[model samples]
Target chain A: MLCLIAWVVFGILGLFSVKYRVLAKESFDCVFRRITFKKCNSNLDERIKSKLTGNLMKFSPKMARGVYRHYEFLSWIFVALFVVSLVLGAQGAYNLAMYDNCAGPNADPDQCIFTPDYDVVDCDDPLCDDGHCEECGDDCDCEECS
Target chain B: MMNVEKIRKDFPIFEKKKFIYFDNACMPLRPKVVIDKINEYYTEYPACAGRSYHDFGTRLTDEVANARDLVKKFIGAKKAKEIIFTKNATESINLVANSFKFNSVLTSDREHNSNLLPWQKFDHDVVKSKKDFSFDLESFSDKVKNFDIVSMVHTSNLEGYSLPVKEIIKIAHEQGAKVLLDGAQSVPHKEINVRKLDVDFLAFSGHKMLGPNGVGVLYGKEELLDGMKPFILGGETVSDSTYDSYKLEELPHKFEAGLQNYPGILGLGSAAKYLMKIGRNNIEKHENMLKSKIDIEGVEKIGHVGESGIFNFNIPGKGAHEVAMMLSASKNIMIRSGAHCMHSWFNSRNLEGSARASFYLYNTLEEIDTFVEELEKIKKL
Candidate 1:
């Protein structure tokens, strides 16, 4: 399952460095075997797990033990998190394209980076002059203003 | 006792990097003298050893001869001519396997792939190890009479347990069988005298003994080497040639074919000299002392932590490679993992593999402490 994340991370890193390319290929093989219901003969998962746990052992033995013991579970959790993020990102992109806001229609524009900055105007207010709200000083174009 | 600190100074790797190197069984770190010797060959006299008449060639030929003589002396061979240079111990064993006439061959079950693979072509049988993983001498004694040649590893790389070669050779000889000892692991760690052992042949690599790679020695009794034909033939192997037939050179030359690894050979000679200066007995003692300090609980040890420098073990429920990698990642402690080319032994036992940490002369007690500390932390995992 760690190979799932490794495949994506190392795949991108592989494009820039030769060293990561070898690891990327190994992780790719691991992920491929995993999805095909075969064992990962490449041992990429074990290598990553050990390397991570080993480094952790230097600072905290208890933490290292926990990590080593639950490496597979942790890998699954990370993979799940990655999948969730991917799905959310895709949904956000869809909402931004359809309703002009990543959080969907009637949501705050501040919630989405792609949402264009615009002034909030109340066309029915008395403060609205020339069909433009007061808050929309220079860059506002309400229906009445148009 | 060897001054570990002073000895560490000889190897330039120590100066360049800080890591506890425990993979001596795979290959020991090269010392500055060996490196300088190799560099000297490339810088001073980089020419064909035997074929050329120029000064560079003549000098190289002398250096190559000197290296052979050093190797012969190192192994206590009767004559320098008995020493034949090859790429490594594997090639040396292959040369013997190809050239030596034998109806049947016998080997120990704990042979490295190098010693085991070559004899697969012949009528080969393996002597099973004892319950404690020691050499089964009684089993070997019973099997010797049925075989023409007894090929065995002198010192096991898996655990560093040296087979009783002196006794094994005597038994093999009594049964009218010749012996070929794979000294790849033994020759580097301890002193081996072929004449004293009365062994017919011995093969070992130079890289394992603080030398450069791509050079190895095959020491055969002169009479046996004389009876056998050359395994490989080319430029330097022949004295004279005809349109119809060719006459092969004598002894070592016939066995060593083509242009040789001159720099590696010279470096190996320097390595031999370096080992001699340090003393093999000192190395063996220092390693034993270091091995004695390894006291970790809750982990299963592979072999008896005996007099040798190797310590093989596995943390329960943890993969051998995982433990080894963790140790490296935690403290930069280098060790060998997996079956160590002895897959037959591990497979027969139904074991995945064992992590092996082998010590050498330069290895200190402090390093052993760090290794133990790391193992204890890993054992919890």
Candidate 2:
């Protein structure tokens, strides 16, 4: 699970650079295979885990052994946190679009909230004068706004 | 203020397992932040310290120095120079037992081998612990005048019983004997002000706490360290080395002796800061509260739970190893069993070892309930 999340994090990083794109593609393929009941490249997972935890051997051999033993369990946690972060970011965006606030219902009107378009606008301001938000203009593309 | 749920969130291990982690006495799980700090070293500055004149090297040196200062503060040392980083507590104890010239060394029977075995090199005697698992302080005080150094564990690893270190140190000092505290079990669980404790030397490992492994600290008084010879000698430990003789470096470097675990040291600094910010009193309180929730009467028990969050118990008609294995296999509950590195102490008593459930700040009462529930099944098994 940790390997999968690490691959995802690496993949997101890979999106920014052409150098890591091939590695990310191969890693994603492995992840997809494992999840979809195909003959996944287990070696790819091992490679990613070693890449992540190999330096730990110098740090402490005992700890390195533990990391290898628990890599599957750790990956699940990493994936869960990644998912949680995605949900939180999405919820924050949702609240901003629907309620014109990131703190959801009881948001302080004086506080500036971030919108989906990366614009920070005060909650007290009239966000949508008509059917569109003033801060995001026509590009205020969000779940509630769309 | 001590929210177990919120605290558990900081430790990623909770989300990774269905088990209640009661093996904290061996190694507490690291928080995500501590892991990030270690990763920061690898990602940002993976350079060697005290060797290269490069920007990364210089920065790494400063970071290591900062960690030293933080550790000094964590243990309440009078100066940062007093803290010496080693591989682990075993190395730290060996450093003192080897370097410090003493006619005879004194130690308790209940010390972890890290503390107990090091005394083999020198003339040493073991003071026994009472049947209640507490140290026989009277025996220690009686023998204090005989030894030049009285080295003892501040806390017992097997029983989790705390020794009367303050009182023992006083008696040892009065007898002109230097005291070294094996603080591996004590430092992570409670606040220890070395100056207040007035111990001559204190040794502990970072992994026992919520820090990375491969880094341990031996804190001695500046004067005591200055007087003692360096255990390991050569490179980075000398200011100048002639063909014939070498001028040793200052207090800590003289002891460090080689290229140290820079990343581990930095992570340890972060761990110390994290624990301090949470306040040791509060961590102790949380562990105490969790201890109160454990129902040990239903399970076959050996000794009462100590103030520190450790319960050592035996199951009737079951080997400790079998009980530990069954617990892990059946319910996924993790614990430590057997002698716990105090083999001499256990052997002397002519008894088989017991299963140990040691808790940390991240443990919850609900988890304790799960542990008890599983132990009940293991008993039936």
Candidate 3:
């Protein structure tokens, strides 16, 4: 597990040193601004009497600064959100994997985090307390047997 | 008094949608102060903190130091050096979990994965978390003496039922067990007085408390922090080094191993300052007011609006993942569904699962009404 973390950390460190900037794809011409082309993965439209949408942007030679920036801002926002969500996902999963123990002396061997599948309480205990294992009787107690 | 509309204007997200972003229980949205703070760091003072001697480095160091001081005042930590910035609440817990040595750590199921897993991973025995999803007093009384440390979540990430930290800390003190509170879910929704709580350690993430992500806090009691091991080591964390042996830097410096996220740290300080300026009491009152308005049309939709945030709940019978996909497909409204990272706590119970819609101070009552109203359509699925 430590090996995996070290590998990931190494990978991230390598990424930081690499000097590169990536950009998104865009239409080849200004006329294409009114349209975004999506290749339909489907063979037929299922019913083809459809006129394609030319979702045109109104020509605003003079628009409010904030309004004009909002579209550009949104495009960047989408990019930022996408990247951040990706980064945060990695950080979260890493934290979970790194902190992979709840198997101490105070822990019920049954409730150890690594064993995410384990039933918290014995099914046959007297109380059979649904959530709280402490409320259970000695039914799941294999400690003495061990 | 903090005006909702005034605060709302600073967060452009409110202008974008129905805007009932109540899941501050998970992460708080960033404000202009935090956003500007981060932008300033990147644009003006982009430098590695504590790792260089140049002017840019010194400027970064001063900003981070000032941010740390702000953290000290925010949490009422005895000293600024006790504050260690981490990625999130989970990372903070992992840092605290791995840093300290104790025979065993006592924790409850009420804790988020951040608090539970790290302590759990220390190869320590985890006592059964209390019933009713609240801290069991008897459990603490019976168990603290048997363990070397105690960890707790200040509140349940799900229900927002608060634990008595002051009382829990007192009990742990009596038993010589160190207490650490997972303050991530609780802090942004409410103010924290770490000194008054008297917990040996407290872990919190900034995103959940009106700050940016990639920044969190570990506030340790001065003496315990002095004794605990550092989270990561290298670079600025070291005072002097040789191939054979190296000396560690002092307090917080020794703990922050690499080029820590200076921008996030600054954002975190600003977030705390913003929350403080607004006052904790008002924030709590505002959130609870929204939460109190959660309504049900019938038994069917009740399953849809399970409990908290618009996107932070699991729909029963329907696979959480499927509902999440559907919600995103039909509407641009974003949400998280399914067993959050605390799947173990949920798996422990016989109950199936629920949908959540956690509330925050910035959310308007009108938004809540709109969400509850729109959620009525969700049951149709």
Residues B21-65, candidate 1, lDDT per residue (tens digit)? Answer: 999999999999999999999899999998888999999999999
Q: What ranges in model 2 sit over 4 Å off? A: A1-146, B298-300, B303-305
TM-score of 3: 0.67
Residue-wise C-alpha lDDT for candidate 2, range B305-365, written one tens digit per residue: 4676788888776567656765565456788988898788778878778888888888888
Clashing pairs in 1: none
Winner by TM-score between candidate 3 and candidate 1 = 1
Instruction: After the best TM-score superposition of candidate 3, give how far the Cα of residue A145 lies from its true spot, in angstroms.
Output: 99
- Residue range with the least summed lDDT across 10 consecutive positions in model 1 chain B: B299-308
Residue pairs clashing, model 2 = A1-A75, A2-A75
Q: What are the lDDT figures for the candidates, one per model?
A: 0.91, 0.80, 0.64
Sorted by TM-score, highest first, which candidate order results? Answer: 1, 2, 3
For each candidate in turn, the TM-score is 0.92, 0.71, 0.67
Model 1, B40: alpha-carbon shift in Å?
0.5
Candidate 2 lDDT tens digits, A1-146? 44466567678889898767776777778778878878665456655555444345435546655765687887788788889998988988778878777768587744534633355433344674544666566554432532
